[model samples]
Every structure is written in structure tokens, then in C-alpha cells.
Target chain A: MPDVLAEALEQVQREVDGAFDAFLPVPEDTRARLVEAMRYSVIGGGKRVRPLLVCATAQLFGVTRQAAVNAGCAVEAIHAYSLIHDDLPCMDDDEMRHGKPTLHKAYDEATAVLAGDCLHALAFDILTMSDTSNDPFVRAELVAALSRASGHEGMAGGQMMDIVSDEQEYDLQQVTRLQQLKTGALLAASVEMGAILGRVPPEGRTHLRAYARDIGLAFQIADDLLDVEGDEEKAGKALRKDEGQGKQTFVTLMGRDAARAQAEILVEQAGQHLASHGADATLLVELARFIVKRDH
Target chain B: MPDVLAEALEQVQREVDGAFDAFLPVPEDTRARLVEAMRYSVIGGGKRVRPLLVCATAQLFGVTRQAAVNAGCAVEAIHAYSLIHDDLPCMDDDEMRHGKPTLHKAYDEATAVLAGDCLHALAFDILTMSDTSNDPFVRAELVAALSRASGHEGMAGGQMMDIVSDEQEYDLQQVTRLQQLKTGALLAASVEMGAILGRVPPEGRTHLRAYARDIGLAFQIADDLLDVEGDEEKAGKALRKDEGQGKQTFVTLMGRDAARAQAEILVEQAGQHLASHGADATLLVELARFIVKRDH
Candidate 1:
């Protein structure tokens, strides 16, 4: 685990945080409070996993640092917005996230809603900005990919399914579909958008996408497993709430041993998709392994 | 009153409707219900005033009909999303819109939220699509214009101001700023987007923006006047809602006669901004007049 890839990840995390701070509205703006809420929701939180995926995937093709960071910021913004809304009283109703009070508690419900919304808009704004890429086509493609991943046909729709399922029951297939849209869509988009930033043609991106698909499911399975067995201090949030909430998850449905085994297999399969990319994909492959083995 | 301009309005309205239907997710999709709620919130409703502004403004620059329609649809989707979110119980708490139950009333709060979010995503989706323009720069500019108009510094920030205004009081300037962001920003962006579609340079767009600013205020005044004087049946929803909520508006602050006079002056000023464009601006001028003269 102590490898060049791990060191690269630590560096990528700092770069991603800097990009977020640069893109977010400053505290001096007249509408500073709203921007403040946006910063609260986006900055000083998360594993920066999506950004890592973006940078790692982009590295495979020698994409420009700015282009990779720009797309990384876009996807990370989407991830942050989803988390803000997901913590709303009407949604998951969690009071704490990443060891801090959720945005709504720190500000207010309306600000939380608006902040999430603004973050969502900011993602597109950053992607479409000139700094993201010189080519307009790349910008448009990034918007299309990110929007589809984060929108109703994707994350928002999956959220609806998640909320609905709380009052009903979902089989393994239904929950899988929900998770794919809920978490996997954005995760896959991070990789897809990175490929786009690097100008990877659709034909060439097939294996990368295959890699993303495998990692997406494995990431969720790992998340479910963490909720069951991980330490709260390391996770920075409540664990085992999935069971307490009566929500069905991979670990609950598949049994802990079976789910863990499945995640390991998926990680192996994810690596296989990078077989043709040689050593260039070392970071991405290592990322898949990290998802399964990380304490958080 | 019955002129070619009015006839063009009807045509533009139909085109916008068709574009919305075409962009919305198909009914046969597994996520059809979310799309249905989105469609229900967007289609067969309202005056399509924003789209008309888009098309008419684009026409002034000889922009392609398809290009104009694409941008028009993008603006309409934002307006619809704003309205859906504005009507949420935590916001305005309206039960009906355009003579039908609000998205939440018909579906549920979660669906309403997701539908609003989806519509917002769809706006960007439509804007970045190749059909909007072959030139990626134009598409990128469109995304930038639309996102800034719809984001924190624009619509969402205005909404936050509005919700907070319920707990506090705002002076004329503050309320004007609020309205400008909430309503005027999108209205201004409609005209700006049309200009972008037409490849009008920033310097050339100043007057068109002035026209939009004037019309944006006039449109709000007319709306307030309608709340005071118009019939609910024609308006397709409740009237006098502003007064019922004790919300301050142009009509309330300026008094009815002064507000009406201000609207007339503003509309005339709006028309004057387009005077340099000559007969090509006829439709836009007529639209400015129509905004104030219409009962609903």
C-alpha cells in the first residue's frame, strides 16, 4: 500500500481542495452567506475519491493538469451537492457528516437547499469555463456526461428510488440499480469525464468504462461493508446505520463474507480492464484496491 | 393589437412546447414517472414568455430557428425548475400552478425535488447538445450563460433572499435585487443567450441586455398588477396571492396607479432599446408591450 500511487493520491487530494477553494464564491461577496454554505458543504470534507478517479484516469492519457483538475472539480462539486441534499431532513436526515454538522444544521434548511443547488450549477459552470479546456467540444462533452450522471436519469432519480424504498421493499436487483444511479453514476462519470478531458475516443474508452463499472459496484459494496464493520473515528460518521435504518445493503443481503469476497473479485476484474493500458493505469487500478481495503 | 408579431408569438410557443417534449425522457423508460412529473411541471403550462423572449431576440440576429428553439427550451426548463422549487412547502407552499396541482401535490415532495433537479439538469443537457450549435464555443457560452443565470449568483441566490425576506424586511433596492436575481437574471439570460446564439459580441449585446432589464422589471410589475386585478380563471391559478402572503411587490410599494404607470414607461423604454435594430426588432418591441398589457 505504501507505493507511488498512494503518494500521488495524497498530492491529488491537496490539488482538488485547492481547485474547490478557487472555484467557490469568496466570503467577501455580498451574497457571502450562501457561498459560505456552499464552501462548507464542499470544502474540508469527503475522501476526494471522485477527484482522485478523475486525475488518475486523466493521467492515463497525459491530460493537462488544469483540464484534469477542472473536470475533477466538476465531478467533486456534484458529489458534494448530492451529499448536502442527501442529508436534508426530507432525505437521509443525518445530522452529522464527515465529523461535522451537516450544512443545514450549520446554516438553515433553505440555505442548504440553495447551496446544494448552487454547487450543482457551479459544476456545470466550471466545466463550461475556458480554463477547463480550449476545445469547446470537450467542454460540451463534460457537461453532457456530468449532467446525465448527476441528473434525474441518474443520481436524482436514484435518490427518489432510495427515499421511496424506505417506505417499501427493494430486492437485490432494485437496490443495485438504485446504488448504480445513486453513487456509481457519479463515480463512473469521474472516470468518463477524465477520459473526455484527455480526448479519449469513445472506441478507446470501452475498457476504461468497463474498469469504471467494476469499480463502481465494488466501491458501493465496500461502502456497505464499512458501515457494518468500520471504526467511526476512521469513517468520520456513524457506522451500522444501514442496519438501524432497516435499509437493505449488499452486506445485509449477501452476507458479510460473501459481499467482501464479491468486492475483492470486482476489484480484480476492474484491474483486468486496464490490462491494455499497461503501467499508465497503475493509479486507477490501485484506487480500486484502495476502495476495498481503506478503513474509511 | 392583432399584428404579425402576435402570430409569430403563437408559432414560437408551439415550437418551444415541441422542444420540451422532445427533450424530456421518454414515457416508456423505467424512470418514466420522474420524467412524467418533469413534463407535467413544464409542458402545456404557462405563457412560455421566456422562450418567446429567447426566440424573438434570436430572430433579431437572424439566428437559425433550430438554434433559437434549442436555447429557448433551455431557458424554459430553468423557469420550470425554479417554479417547481419555489412552490415547495418550505418555500411558497402553493397547491396549484397553471390550473393543475403543483408537482409535489400531484406526486410528492421528494418527486417534486427530484423533478426540479432533473429539469435543471435537462436545461444544461439541451444547451450542450450538438443540435444547439455545431460550434462548441457557442454551446459552451450558452452553458455558461444559462448556469450563471440559474445558479447561486442568480436564481438560487434570489430564492434564498426571497425565503429569508419572509423572516425579515427588505427595502425597495433589496427587493429589486432579489427580484432581479430570482426573475430578472433568468429573463436577462434569455435575451443574452439569444444574442450568444446569434454570435452577437458582448459590446453589441449591451442594448439587448438593457431591453431585457427593462422588460424584466415591467414583467414583474405586470405580474404584480395581475395579482391585484386579474381574474384567477384567466391567470390559471390563484390571484391576489402576493397580498395574501403579505409579500411586498411593485404594486404594494408603488401603489396600483404608479405601478401601472411605471410598467408602461418601462415597456416603452424596453422598446426604445431595440429601436436601433429597426424593423427587425418589431417582435421584441411587441413582446415588451405584451408583457405589460396582458391580463395574465
Candidate 2:
């Protein structure tokens, strides 16, 4: 990885961790356990890729680092909460995430559920705060973009498709659409929210949107590749479940070589979209490259 | 109920149902089941008390019925989602709500969890839309208020306390604190969001906040009483579960008669807080009285 890109990722991870820590103070009451569960999941682990995306995109238009990080934290919160729910005994029933016991396993299933819910609400709370942006328009638009990406028409809808995948046979197009909603929506939203924080108008966001779309797809294709061939210790969670369950994915549908090739091509195209930004886009361009190349 | 209050409640219920119906359209693809689950839980049932509170308070500031109803719908979405999660087997583990099978029981646990999450995201989605409030400030504030009320510091946190109540011997103050977060926060947020739509600043909302607080406590007290003395058929779900679990409650802590008396007193006090609005507050006052008097 490029030094600048690696450094940016590291800084965002730390900032997001600090922000979550500050925002969620354990209350001196019985509610402490719930907050503790939330903190346990949110404050650590994971690669903070979403926050890196937000900060990288926001930097294009001179948005403040604090503002970008705050918005990034909001998106990360949504991502974290979704992971919590996705790992529940009633859902994926996974016991490990980021190499630790999933929230339900760490606490109880009920605490896991509530912690996920509280984190879900906290995403909007963070976006709506003045700390995210001094302008109400920016804050409102951030909330709109993030919420839309998180809702039934977006991530949750995709999740439903995933849950049903066990019983249904989906074609390549269907799987792509499902992945687009399930994993792509929030990834796209991370970039869009950063643009919103920078006060980028809708007309001015076309390239940024395209860039996000390309990387979103590439990110998932790479994920499929990882699940098929990556080391479980490095991946920090169970992999190959899709193969075990006979679920169709990019790897299963397109073959391993084609999936890798497609992800690389998408990442290249993602970088091309940022060409208009010149040198200022270095981190974003590198981030795209890293998305497909990362071991995890 | 007085003719006017009954008519207002009827209208709000119909409008809320209509709003949710319009907002959630079942898709024509693999994601259809998820949307169906969300629609099933949100479109019907419940008293629509939160919506009524929003409309009643918004009316005090001459806010349009449509705008108020939209904001009210946002709050109702949160309320509906909370019920869905609360009734999950891992949570409250109930099989019924609002006279119908709970989402998990009707569908599956994963679907129910996803539906609840989607609805939770949808609340913020509705609030950020221009249909809820055209002003960006209003939209942002609405998101902030609703998210805060729904999150750890409020409803979800209260739920955490309730989950632990089975093991902990909570006194009256502890129970009150728990209920305040669990139920009072959302109810109060309903009134607060309505006031926000009407452009009522925080300082101008003191009386309305007090009114909401009073009725919020009264509402829970009534719920506790109903749990002890009301029929299961009318309540539309299990009754005496708190007693069955030997959990502390307003009725258990205060005794049935004192709980009843306290609710009535809170109702009267809630009405008094609206006295400054004269006859214009009639609907809100009646709603408060109904909070304590309703069988369900």
C-alpha cells in the first residue's frame, strides 16, 4: 500500500474509535450493560474501510477532517449495527467477527439485539448532530443518504435476498443485484455522505457517485474472492460458508480468476473516475486498489 | 371519550395507516418478503398514540396536518420497529402483538430482525424527506430527537433495563427510571417532534414537554394496571407476564390502587400543563385522560 493511503486508513481507524468512545459514555445505571455491549462491538476491531472512504471523498472538496470523521463514524455505526444483527443466532448464527465472539456470543442474544438497535439509532443521531456539520442542510442530507442506504430499499433489502439465497437459485444478474443492495449500498453511501458534508451539489456528484459504485462492486467481488480462498486467521471470521452452503457468489458464478480480474478492472475504473481530482485523489485511488488487494 | 377527541384519534389512525401504506411498497423481486414483513407490522394495529401526540402538539402551532402526520409517521415507525424487536424470541419472545402474530412468529426470526431494522432506518428516512418538513433545520432536529429517543439513552436503554428486571429487585424509583427511558422517552419525543415541525423552539416547548412527560408516566402506569387487572382478549396479547416472571412493576411497587390513582393524577396534571393553550389543547388533554382510562 502507498504510505499516504496506509497512514490515512490508520488515522481514520483511530479517530473513529475515539469518536465512538467519547460519544458512548457508560452510564452509572443498569443501562450500563447495554451501552457496554454497544461499546464492546463498536469501539474496536474491523478495518474501518467505510470511514476511510468517507474521509477520502470528503477531502476532495476541502471538508474538515473532524467533520469527515464524524460522518464516517455515523456510516461505520450503521455498518457495525448491521454486522451485529447479521451475526445473531436467528440470522447467520456466526460466533466470531473480527476474530472475537460476535455480540450475541459476547453478551446474550437479547443484548446483542438491543445493542444493534441502539447503534442503528446512534448512526442517525451522529449524522444529525452539529458536530457532523455546521450547516443543517449538510447534516440533513447526510442523514437522508445514510438512512436510505441502510433501509429496506438498500442494505436490509439486500440482506433479505441473502437470507433467501439458501432456498432459491439466483443467476449472475440476480446475485449481482443482491450484492449491490446488501453490501454495495452502504459503501456507496459512505462516499455520498462525504460529498454531502463537503456541500457538493447533486449535479457535481456524478463522478463521485460513479467512483463509489465501481469500488462498491469491486469491494464485494473481492470479498467473494476472499471468502473462497483467503486465510481464516487473517480474515478474522468464518470464510467459505458460501461454498459450504452452496450459495452462488461472484466467485461461484464467474470463476475465481474471472472474479479477481473483474475486481481489478473495477478498481482501475474507480481510480479513473477520480482522474479529475489529480494529485489530491491519490489516497482515494490507492484505497480502491487496496480494496481488491487486501488479504482481509 | 368526547366526540371531538374520538374523532381526532380516528382521523389520525387512518392517516397514519395511509401514510405507512404509501411509504412501503412491496417490491416485485426476491426482496418482496422483507417488504411484506415490514408492511404487515407497520400498516395496521396499535392505537397510533405517538402519531396523535405529534398531530395534537403540531396543531397547537398551526402546523399543517399533512406535515405533522408525516413526522408522526416517522415516530410511529420507530415505535413499530421497537415492538417487533421487543417481541422477538431472543428479546421478549412473545408470539403476539396488536391482536396479530408477532413478526417473528408470522414470518421467521431473521426476517423479523431485518424488518425491524429496516423500519428503524425508515424512520430517519421519512424525517429527512421534504415531505416530513421542508426546512432543513426541522428535518435535522427531527432526526436528532427521534434517534436520541430511540437509542441507548432512551427506549433501547430502557428495554435493556426491562430485560434485567427479571433478575434484579428494582424499587419504585428504579422502575420509574426504567419506564421513563423505555416508554417516556419516545412518547415525549412524539410531542417534541410535533413541536419541531411547527417551528417551536426548545424554550417554547417547556409546557408541551411537561405535558408529554406527565402522560408518558401515566401511560405506563395504566399499562401496568392493565397487566394486573385487564382481560387478555382486550389487551390483545398476554397479560400478567410481569407477575408470571415476578418482575417489579408500577403496580407491584405502588400497589394496584395507588398505581391507578397516580395515573389519574398524572393525567390531570398533564391536562393542566396544557391550560395555557385554552380550548386549543382539548385534543391533547383528552388524549392524556385516555392514556389512563383506556382498557388497552
Candidate 3:
């Protein structure tokens, strides 16, 4: 990781953690099991890559760091909730994530389900709260953008596509659509949310959105790459499930060398969208490259 | 049912259904099965009680019927999503609702999960859309109220407490708290959302909230009473779930006559809260009385 970018991300992660801790109900609450599961899933693990994107994109328009952090927390909470749901027995049924037992495995299935629901609700709670923005318009935009990215036409829809993968044959176009919905939507929304918070007009945000799209696609390609060749300990979960499930992926469909080439091209293209911002977009440029290169 | 409330709620139900049908992603979408499940759950059935709450309360302040309809759709979607999740194999594991197979029973588990998620997202989507409210502040307020009512410390928390019920012994207070979180929160929020839509000030809305709280508890007590005495055909879903699960309920703890009397008292108190509003609150009062008397 580049020193400046890594340092910035590390700081953002801490701030995001503080926000989660502050907002989440503790284990002593009436629904202690659900709260415990929620806290466990969100408190101290995973790279806050989505939150960093929000912060970096907001910085381009000189928005307040606090505003960016609050929005970032909302996105991360949604991401965390999705992961918990995805890891459920009826879904991916993964036993581990972030180097620990997944929420369902660590607790019970019912508790995991409710915790995921709680975390999902918490995301909107964060967006609409007073701390997110002084302007209710900003809060409304965040809620709208965030829900669009996570809803039926976005992450949830993509996940359904993924679930049908084993039973249905998917061509590259289909796979691309799946990846775009499942993963790219939230990532793109993260950047879009930052733009919204910074008071950027809708049309004014085309380039930033383009940058997010490229990197979002590139991020998935990188995950596919990691699934093929990464270390399990570093990755902190089961690897090569795509291959085992016989699912179509960037590497499998495009071949390893071509897939690697495509990701590099995307990463480079992602940076160009930030060109007009010059030095203000440096962290974003670095982050885009990092997405395709990070081992986990 | 009273003539005014019965007619009003019947019209509100149609409007709410239209909003849901208009907003939901169709079966032709990529994850068509999940969409199908969602449509099956939300399109045709249920009493639409929550939506009625929003509409009736909004009427108290003369808010637009369209605005109330939109908010009603939002709350009903959340309620639908909760029912879907609760009916999952790991949760209540129920086979039927609204006289039909549950989502998981009608479809598959994964599809049910994704459908539940899609419905949850749609609730927020409804709030943020311009058709719901022209004012962004009102939209933000709706999102916050809806989420707080449904989230960890609210509906989700109540669900968690419910899951622990079979495993642990609980007294009346604990049971009441569980019922409040699981069921009362959303019912209360339905009334609250209507007030927010009408731009009713927070301080001015306490009596309306009292009205809702009273009815929310009454609603649950009615359900318990129905479980013990209502006909299976009229109720649609299986009766006697509390006895089957060995779950303690108002009827189990308070006994049948006492529980019935409590529901009646609550319904009366609920009407009393609306005395200041006179005839404008007639529908809410009628609805409260209807809760204990409805067959389903």
C-alpha cells in the first residue's frame, strides 16, 4: 500500500469503527444476542474500502470530513449487513469471514438473520440522523442513493443472479451483469453518496461516477483473481469457491492473462476520470489501483 | 367495522396495493424468481392494517390522501418483509400466511431471503421518492421513523427477544417488552409517519402516539386471542402457534378473559386519545375496535 493512501484509509477505518460502536446497541440490551452478532460483524474487521471511497470522493469537492465519515458509516453498515446475509446457510453458507466464524456460525441462524436486519436498518438510521448532514436534502439523497444500490435492482438482485448461477448457464454478458449488480452497485453508490454529501449536482458527477464504475468492475476482477491465486490466511476466508461451484468469472471466461490485462486497463481508466481534479483526486487514483492489486 | 372506517380502509388498501405494484420490480427482471416471491407476498393479501394506520392518522391533519398512500406502502412493505423473514425455516418456520403458502414454501429458501431483502429496500425507496413527499425534510423524517421502528432496538430487537423466549423463562414485563419491540414499534411508527407527513410538530403528536401505542398492544392481544379461539379458515394461517411453540403470550400469562378484557380496555383507551380530534379520529378509533374483532 502507498504510504499516504494507506495512512488515510487507516484513519478512516478508525473513525468508521467509532461511528459503528457509538450507534450500535450493546449486548446488554433486551435483544442482546442480536446486538452481539451485529457488533461482532461490524466492529473491528475488514478493510473499510467502501468508506474510504466515500471519504476520498467527498474530498474532491472539499466536503467536511465528518460528513464524509457519517455517510461512509452508512455504506459500510449496509455492506456488513449484506455480508452477514450472504453468509447465511440458505445463501453462500460460508463458515468463515474476516478470519473468524461468520455471524450465523458464531452465533445461531435466527440471531444472525435479525442482526443482519438490524444492521440494514441502522444504515438508514445513520443516513437520516442529524449527524449525517445539516441539510435534510443531503440525507434524503443518501437514503435514495444507498437504497438504489442495495435494493432489488442492485445488490439484492445481483445476489439472486448469483444464487441461480449453478442451475443456469451464464455467458460473459450475464456474468458481467451479475457482478455489476452484486458488487459494483454499492461501490458506485459509495462514490455517488460522497458526491451527494458534497452538494455536487447530479450532472456534475458524471466523471466521478465513471471513475467508480471502472474501479467497481476492477474490484470484482481482482476478487476473482484472488480466488484463483491468493493466500487463504491473508484472504481470511474460503478461497476458490467460484471454481468449486463452477461459476463463471473474469479469470475463467477471459483467461488468466487477459483477465489480469483487463483489470489493469480498468484501473488505469478509473484514474483518468479523476484527471480534472488533479492533486485533489490523488487518493482515489491510488485506491483504484489498489483495488485491482490488493491480495485480499 | 364502522361504516366510515371500513370504507376508508378499503379504499386505502387499494391505493396502497397500487403503489406497491407500481414500485416493485417485475418478474421479468434478472432475478425474476425473487421478484415473483415478493409480488406474491405483497400484491394481493393481508389486512393492510399498518397502511390503514398511516392513512387514518394522516386524515387527522388533512394530509393529502396520495401522500398517506405512499407512506402506507412504505410501512406495509416493511411489514411484508418482516413476515417473510420470520416465516423462514430458521425462524418461525411457518408454512402459511394470508391463506397461502409462505414465501419460502411457495418459492425456495434463497429466493425467499432475497425477496425479503428486496421488500426491505423497497420500503426505504418509497420514502425517498418524490411522489411520497415533495419536502426532503419530511422524506428524511419518514426514513428515520420507519427504520427506528423496524431496526435492532425496535422490530428486529423484538424478534430477537422472541427467539430467546422458548429457551428462557420470562415474566410479564419481559413479554410486554418483547411484544412492544417486535410488533408495537412498527404499528406506532405507522401513526407517527402519518403525523410527519402532515408536518405535525413533534410535541403536538404525543396524543396520536398514545393512540397508536394503545392500539398496537391491542392488536397483539387480539392476535393472541385469535390464536386461541379464532377459526383456522378465517385466520388464513395456522392457529395455536403459541401453544405449539410453547411460547408464552398475553393469553397464556394473563388468561383468556383477562386478555380479552385488556384488549377491549386498550381499544377504548386508544379511542380516548383521539377525543381531542373529535370526528377526525373516528377512523382510528374504529380501527382499534376492529383489531380485536376481526376474524383474520
Residue B194 in candidate 3, Cα distance off native in Å: 0.6
Regions of candidate 2 where Cα sits further than 4 Å from its true position: none
> What's the ranking of the predictions by DockQ, best on top?
2, 3, 1
Best DockQ goes to which candidate? 2
How does chain A of candidate 3 score by TM-score against the true chain A?
0.98
| Residue pairs with backbone overlap in model 1 | none
Estimate the TM-score for candidate 1.
Answer: 0.94
Scored on chain A only, each candidate's TM-score is 0.96, 0.99, 0.98
Worst lDDT 10-window in candidate 3 chain A: A24-33
Name the candidate that leads on TM-score.
2
Better of 2 and 3 by DockQ: 2
- Give one digit per residue, the lDDT tens place, for model 1 in A130-151: 8899898899899999998888
Residue B20, candidate 3: Cα error in Å is 1.4
Instruction: Assess the local accuracy of residue A33 in candidate 1 as a C-alpha lDDT between 0 and 100.
Output: 81
Query: All candidates' TM-scores?
Result: 0.94, 0.99, 0.98
The lDDT values for all models are 0.86, 0.92, 0.90
lDDT of 3 by residue, A1-296 (tens): 89988899889989998988888757565587778789899989989999999999998888888889999999999999899999999999899899999999999888888888888899999898887898999999999999989988899999998998888888888888999999999999999999998899999999998998899889998999999999999999999999999998989899989999999999999999888999888999999988988988
Which window of ten consecutive residues has the lowest lDDT sum in model 1 chain A?
A: A23-32
